[model samples]
Target: MITLDFDGFKSEIETPSEDLRIYNFWATWCAPCIHEMPYFESVVKDTKGTNLVFVSLDDDRRPERVKAFVEKKGFSSPIWLLSEKEQKDWKQKLKEDWSGAIPATLFVTAAGKRHFHTGQISEEKLKELIETYK
Candidate 1:
């Protein structure tokens, strides 16, 4: 897990040189979101050297609390805190059908392609999806 915020995310995912950009939107408060942590971590572990940017959708007013939550849980994946505007903007860009769901994840590679999962994903299935990209 590598820590990144809005600008860093732009540099990584928006970069022309990078390949396989993954964005996982999560929060510490959501149970389902918490449950999906291990899955993303497993993805990071299994897909070493792949580009994955994890962003925290927690309220910006409580960044310290969010940071503490991650620390308490001993999370292995790095996270970026999203501003309210950032969250709203992404929800629109991703899909209008979304109700600003938590535990939402998106994957994009240098090929300028995209993949999305709105709910929890199994480890085996994630491995297959990642390998497909490889």
Candidate 2:
């Protein structure tokens, strides 16, 4: 897992690409985020032509704990730990109305369209969004 500040994260995913990129924002302490882990893992394995990345918002001081959690869950998608400490600064950068919620998802289409969902998303909805956006 790589640790990224806001700028690093933006640079990572903001570049133009032909693939549909899905960034799932989560943390180890967030239960709903944890609950949706397997769904994301399953989708990443079964889906084609799409890139899924898990962005962890866990405390920077506990990098080892975050690594252990991801290892225990056996996540296959690329994982990046967000090191930004101020939610107010980065929340709007992700979305205008984002409330700093966990289980949020940012979908970037090949066509350069962006879709953001804030809160727990069902596996069905997740698949549906991918099909619709990809």
The best candidate by lDDT is: 2
Off by over 4 Å in 1: 1-12
- Which sections of candidate 2 miss by over 4 Å? none
Residue 94 displacement (Å), model 2: 1.6
Write model 1 residue lDDT over 51-119, tens digit each, in one string. 655688877777788878878887766677766656656576565677777777777766767777787
Which clashing pairs does model 2 show? none
| lDDT score for residue 36 of model 1 | 69
Error of 2 at 1 (Å): 0.7
Evaluated at residue 26, the lDDT of candidate 2 is 94
